[model samples]
Every structure is written in structure tokens, then in C-alpha cells.
Target: MLLFGTAGIPASTKTNGDTVAGLKRIAELGLGGMEIEFVRGVYLKDNMVPPVAYVGKKLGLKLSCHAPYYLNLNHADEVRRRQAGGVLHHAAGTAARAGARTIVFHAGYYLKGSPETVYDAIKAEMEVVLGKLLDEGTEITLRPELAGKISQFGNLAEILKLSRELPGVAPAIDFAHLHASTGRYNSYPEFAEVLNRVGEALGRESLDDLHLHVSGIEYAKTGERRHLNLAESDFRYDELLQALADVKAGGLLICESPNIEEDTLLLQRTYLDLSPRT
Candidate 1:
């Protein structure tokens, strides 16, 4: 039931083409979805939303979103924290208008705070943001991504707890990040454990509607350095996909490799080979 796609437009998409054009290319490539990357900002203009939604609907593509990189909901500075919250709110509104199912973002860094303190701060901040989104009737799912670095605020347990405690919030499970962050979870059993933990923590329904990011990653002891093509790294994507298939996990699996469309296709093909469900 998983829908495979790129994080943004396919690389083969024509230069100067918009996301509407990207949707067409995704449909042509047989991808079932795309993540509209608001990595810099909510760049999908207000005027373009209808068309983006229309094209995505026509093609049966599930759209999701990644918020800007700089957003840190638990920033140490009050001003920056408020700004981050504002950006997230704006991004969610736009994504919802465009028919996106989820908006993924990094929650924050650990900085000098204890994990307990950081988690509480992030939860409090996100509660306010979610409250605002709800007041505006914007129901787009908020996904705090499982981060790749040790210094980052989010980890598997942290994300699970966040999703468990927060309304409108869920985990954006990045397999590369998990592997890079821990130097483990690169095997079928480890991958299966992750799925089991999510289901255990958030319920089986969460697994049924998972949001995932996949890539081959380079890492140091500190954590993720960069993304690599699946063929170029030790991500064990085949086993990871196998674990997903075994669990019957369903959701949008967005590929974030440098070779976006190619690796996306590889993930789709490999997952299909492992599971009867498309």
C-alpha cells in the first residue's frame, strides 16, 4: 500500500517547469507521490495551489511536504522560536490548501538542555502551533522528523513520544537518519524492530499511515554527513524495504537521494519485488 516518490520534482523534469509540470512527470514515471519541498520556504505560491492539487488528484498522486530546514521549534531564543513556529504554521496552511497529507520538519537541536527539558519545550511550542492550525481548520498532519545527528532533538523514542502526546503530530521516519544516527538499524531485524516500536508506541493505525524518507547516507561518528545513491552506500535498503513489506506498512515513502527519481524507482521496484501489495 506504500506509495513511492521523490522528495521534490523528478530530476528529469524540464528546467523552468513548475510543480504542476513535476506532477505530470511523476505520473509519467509511474511514481505515486511527491514531497513538495518547502525547504527554503513555502514556495508553492497561493495562486498555484489549485492547479497543483488538481494535477495531483488527476494523477492519483499523494502529495506531502517538507518544511524549511531552519525551523527549530525549540530554539533557545524566543524570537527565533516564534519565527520558526510562524513558518511552520504558514507551511502547513499552504500544504493543506494544496491537498498534501503531511508536513515534515526537524523539531530542534539539543543545545545545552537536557533531553527531558528539550522535549518538554518542543512539546509546549508545538501545542501552541497545533492549536493555531486547528483554529484555522488546517488539519494537515504535522510530522517531527527522526533526526540524523546526536545533537539533534529528535530520535526514535522522542518522536514516538511526541506523536503519542501531541494531536496532529506524527513521526517522519527517515531510514537513512536512523542508520546514520545510530550506526545500526541497517538489517531486517533492526528495521522490523523500528516498525514494531512505532506500532507499540502510537498504535497500529500509525503504521498504516506512515511517512517515510529513504536514502543512502554517509556518516561519521558524529552522524549523517550527506546523502548518497543507494548503490553507493551501505544503507541496506533492500532489507529495510523487506522489513516494511513484512509489516505491511503503508504510507508515502519519499526518496531523498541525490539521484531522486532513479533511487525512487529503485525503492519502488525493490519494494514491489518484496511485497505483493503495490
Candidate 2:
């Protein structure tokens, strides 16, 4: 099924910001999953994952993770690479134990070179990261999200190709990033094109269990400015829902809007109410 949930601990969750409490809240709200936000840093303790995993499993909630925000694989400096690698390594183990099948990250930036150069560097870095994680016996999908900004290393093609090339890698296709990156892709047709491309590149199974991000985005000429609540922006989310329904895309849709549960519920309700021709 296409599960809907928030990007972090929901605001309405009681228990003073505990994750298990958040899971219980999600269940109470009739949401199906959540992406544990380690975006600032990977601070999860060694003992924490098992209980989180247990709670999620018991509650029938699917879990996933967002890795730290400071990664940049295209860098020549080994310090940044090492730092990013350690975080990804820690994230894989933590996410796996937390019952998270995928860990999404913004791969890198294109600071000063061709896209080809950036792609190759990032891919090489990912190879090392994946290899280390596998050796450590942490099995989690490493997803390079399509970043927002003309200067970012990841676009749709780059992320998809990375998924196709790497064994344990996938695309975390963020619709907001796509829209912000090019100032288009808000229509139903554009949305379908994206779904079609994902199916074409990674196959039907990937479509059935895709990881995606959706939010109302604010953008400038260069790229994304900030996130907004879905109702407060011109995101054409209704059309996006119709497209998602048409393709029968499943897996988790983590809402990244400012008002997390409100937008998540809005998308969930809209998706459930969609007709193929709507």
C-alpha cells in the first residue's frame, strides 16, 4: 500500500518528544509510517534502534530515515569524505535496527566542475560507503535524493542512474525539489513523466515500493528558498495525487511541509479520494 506519514516526530505526539510516542501518535492518526529525521546529526544511541524497531513493528508502521545534511561526496578533501562516510555508516546500522529499509541523503554539490566529474566522484564515494556498510553487515538502501538547486550534483537522471548502477542504492524522488529545480513539473503530465521514468529505470518493483518526498516549495531563480504548508502554496498537489494513484505507486510518502500532520493527512485523504481520471 502507499503509506502516508510525516518527516519527523509529529507535533501532536505526547510524551515529551519520544520517538515511540510519535509512532503511537502516527498510528492513532491513521498514518502508516515516518522518516526519522537525523538531518542535523546522527545522534541515535546504540540501544535505541531495537526498541524503536519493536514499537514500529508492533504498531504496523513502516519506518525510514533521512541521513545528516552535511555530506558532500564530490569533495577532494578526505576529511569531509571521512566525516560523511562515518555518518552514513552509523546511519545504516541504526536505520536497519530501527526497521528502516531506506536511508535518504542529499549526495553532494557541483561546486566547480562538469556534471560528469561530479557524478563520477559521488559514485566512487558511494561505492566506498556501500562497501563499508556491507562489510559491517548493515543492510539498508542508500538513496541519493534529487536535490533542489541548479548547483546540486543530483538531478533526476543522476539519482536514477546511481540507483541503476549501485546494488543497494535507490532514488528518493522529491517532487518539491524537481519543481524548485526547474520551475516546472507541477502539472499531472509532468508528474506522470517522473513516475514513468522511475519505472523505466528501476523497474516495476521499485515503483511499487518507492520512497518519495512532497511538500509546498518556495523557490527563486537559482532554486528552493524554503518549504511552505501545502495549502499555502501553488503546488498542484491534487494533480500529483491523481498521478500517484494512476501509477499505483506504493511505499512511503513523507510529508516535509511546515505543518507536517496537516499536510500529510491532506495528501492521504486526497490520494484515497482520487479517481484514475481525476
Candidate 3:
């Protein structure tokens, strides 16, 4: 079954409140998973992991993580490149401790190089990071997310290629990013093509065990500008859900809308209703 959840905890929680409490609350809401938003940085202390894991296990909530946005695998400076690798390493470690299976990250930006050159540099850096994680015995998977702009290092084709080359790497296909990056393709046939391509390139197992981010987004010629709430944006989510159900894609689908919990439930309910058996 496909698990649906919000990108982070409900906004009602105070900044000083407990993160474990947030996990329990999400489970209480009937959500099946939560993407711990380490987008700013990794802040989960070692002492908190046991309690968080306990709560997650009791509640049956699947866990995933979003790495910080500061990563840049293609940095021109060697020092910066190594630092980026360290960031990924830290994120991977934290994800494993939190009982999360996948750690999603924005790979990098394409500053002034050709796409091919940037892709090669990013792939090389990812290999180094993955090697370190494997040596350390971390079981978490590193997911390079499909970014939401033209200037980002990750596109569907580029990320899929990287996943093919790297042993443990996978693509986090953000549907909002896909829509913004291409300016269109929200229909059932278009979405099906995406699933077909991924299945063909990465294998059926990869398609079944997907990690996705979905929301309504505003875009321009340059690509995604900002995320909008489901009701406020023009995202054709019904068709998208149908496409996922059609493929029987089973993994975490995290909602990044402004009304996070509300949109997440909407997606879960919509998917259930649109599912083929129904």
C-alpha cells in the first residue's frame, strides 16, 4: 500500500515542543508516514532516537528524511565539495538512527557547466558519499530528488541515469517539481509515461518502492517559484493519483502543501477512492 503523510509536523506545534510528540500526533491523525524535515539542518539528538523510534514503531508510521538544502555536489571549490559530502553523510546517519529507510536530498545546482559536465561531477561525488555510508554500515538509501527548476542539477532523466550507475541511489520524483520543470504534463497519459520510463530504466522494484513529494506549485519560465495549497493551485492531483494507483506504486508520498496535514489526508483519501479496486 502507498503511505501518505506531511513533509513535517503539524504547524500547531510550538517551536519548543517535542518532536516525538509530533510523530505520535501524525499517527493519531491516521497518516501512515512522516518526512522528518531536516531541510534546514540535522537537529535530532542521539538521545532522542530511541524514544522517537519507539513512538514510530508503536504507531506504525513509516519514516523518511529530507536532507538540508545547502548541499552542492558540483561546487567548483574542492573544499566545498568535500563539505557537501559531509552534509550528506550526516543526513544519512541521522536518517538511519531515526528508523528512516530513505534520505532525500536536492543533489546540487548547475552553476555554469553543461548538463553532462554537471551530471558527471555530481555522480562522482555521490559515489564517494555512498561509499562512506556503506563502510560505516548505514542501511539508509540516498535519494536524489527531481528538483523544481531549470537551473537545478536534478532532472528526471539525469537522476534516473545516476540511479542506474549508483548501487544504492534512487530518485525521489516530486510531481510538483516535474510539473514546474516541464511547464506541463499533468494528464494521466503523461504521468503514465513517467512511471513507464522509471520502471524501464530502474526496474519494476524501483517503481513499486517509490519515494515521492507532491503538492500544488506556482511556476514561471524559469520553473517553480513557490508551493501552493491544494485548493489554491492548479495541480491536477486527481489524475496524478490515478496514475500512481494504476502502477500500484507503493511507497511514501509526502505532501508539501501549505496546509500540510489537511492536504496529506486529502491525498490519502483521494488515492483510496481512485484506487483500482474501488
Candidate 4:
């Protein structure tokens, strides 16, 4: 089944650092998942991992994580590139310890390099990262997110290609990002085409266990400006939900709206209303 959740702790959560409290609030809200946001840093301490895992398990909440935004595996500077990889490694390791099934990240920017060169750089670094994680017996999927900006390294094709080439990697298909970046993919047919492309590029099984992101986005000629609350923006979320239901897509869908839980519930309710499988 597709699980819906906030990108991080709900704003109404009483304590900021208490992930247990966040998971409990998610359960009370009747949401099915939570993505720990380490966008600023890997803030979840080693000592707290057990309790977070325990609470999430008790509540039957699916868990995932977003690595720091500072990551740039394609950096020209070797030290800086290694630092970015370190951020991903640390975040993934911590999240895995806390029972998160997947970790999402913006892999890198295109910089001045060709897309082919940049993709090669990112793939090499990610291979090393995956090797180390696998050797350590840490089990978690690394997902390169569909980035919203034109300058970013990950588009739908790039993300799908990366997932295809890498054994332990997958694409985190950000529907809002796809719309903002392309100026299209905003309709039911367009959304269905996206799902079809993924299934074609990856496999039918990929559609069955997708990792997705959704929100209302503001964009410019260059690309994404910011995220908006669903009702306040032009995102055709109802159509998108219908498309997801049509495909019977199953996996974790995290809402990144400013009012996270509210928009999450909006999508969940609307999808259930339209979805035969639900």
C-alpha cells in the first residue's frame, strides 16, 4: 500500500528533537509514514536511534530520511566532494540504524560539466558509498531525488538511469519538482506517462514500490522558486492523485508542503476517495 506522511516532524509536535513524539503524532494523525529531515545536518544522535525505532515500530509507521542539502558529489574540489559524500554516508548510516528503509538526497549540480561527465562522477562516488555501506551490513536504499532546478543533476531520466545502473539506488520521483522543472507533467495523462516511463525504464516492480514526493510549487523561467500549500498553488494534485491511483502505485509518498500534515491528509483523503484499491 502507498503510505502518506510529512517530510519531517509535524509542526504541531510538542518537542523538536523528540522523534518519538513526532512518530506518535503521525500515528495519532492516522498518517502512515515519516521522513526524518537531515537537510541541515544529521541531527539524530546515536543514543536516540533505538527509541525512535521502537516508537515507529510500535506505531507501524514507515520511516525514511533526507540527507543534508550541502551534498554535491560532483564537486570539482576533491575534499569538498568527499565532504558531501560524508554527509550522505553519515545520514544514511544513522537513518538505517533507526530503522529507516530509504534515504533521499539531491545528488549534485550540473556545474560546468557535461551531463555525461557529471553523471559519471556521481555514479563513481555513489558506487563507493554503496560499497562501504554494503560491506558494513547496513541495509537501506539510496534514492537520488528528482531535483526541481534546471542546474540540478537529477531530472526524471537521469534519476531513472542512475537507479537502473546502481544496484542499491532508486529514484525519488518528486512530482512537484517534475512539474516546476519541466513546465509540464501537471495533468493526469502527463502523470500517468511519468509512471509508465518509470515502469518501462526500471521494471513493473518499480511502480509497486515507488518513493515519491509531492507539494504545491512556485516556479520561474529558470525553475522552482518555493513550495506552497496545496490549495494556494496551481498544482493539479487531484489529477495527480487520480493518476497514482490508476497505476496502483504503492510506496512512501512524503508531502513537503509548509503545512505538511494538512496537505498530506488532503492528498491521502482525495486519493482514497478516487482509488479503487484503497
For all predicted structures, in order, the TM-scores are: 0.97, 0.97, 0.97, 0.98
List, residue by residue over 86-180, the lDDT tens digit for candidate 1.
99888888898898979999999999999999999899889888999989888799999999999899999999999999889999999999999
Better of 1 and 3 by lDDT: 1
Give the C-alpha lDDT of model 4: 0.93
RMSD of each: 1.6, 1.2, 1.4, 1.3
Q: Can you give the lDDT of residue 145 in candidate 2?
A: 93
Residue pairs with colliding backbones in model 4 are: none
Candidate achieving higher TM-score, 1 or 4? 4
For residue 14, model 3's alpha carbon misses the true position, in angstroms, by 7.0
For candidate 3, the 10 contiguous residues with the lowest summed lDDT are 10-19
Per-model lDDT: 0.92, 0.90, 0.90, 0.93
Could you tell me the TM-score of candidate 1?
0.97
Off by over 4 Å in 2: none
| Residue 71 C-alpha lDDT in model 2 | 79
Give the Å shift of residue 96 in candidate 3.
Answer: 0.6
lDDT score at residue 235, model 1, on the 0-100 scale? 86
What is the clash count for each candidate, in the order shown?
0, 0, 0, 0
Q: Write the per-residue lDDT of candidate 2 for residues 1-278, one digit (tens) a residue.
A: 79998999998987866888999999999999999998988766778778899999999998999998887877668788777777777877788889999999988889987999889888988999899988888879999999998888899999999999999999999999999999999999999999999999999999899899999999999998999998888899999888999988899999999998999999999998977773
What stretches of model 3 exceed 4 Å from their correct place? 12-17
Ranking by TM-score: 4, 1, 2, 3
Candidate 3, 55-80: lDDT as tens digits: 88888999999999998999999899
lDDT of 4 by residue, 111-153 (tens): 9999999999999889989998999999999999999999999
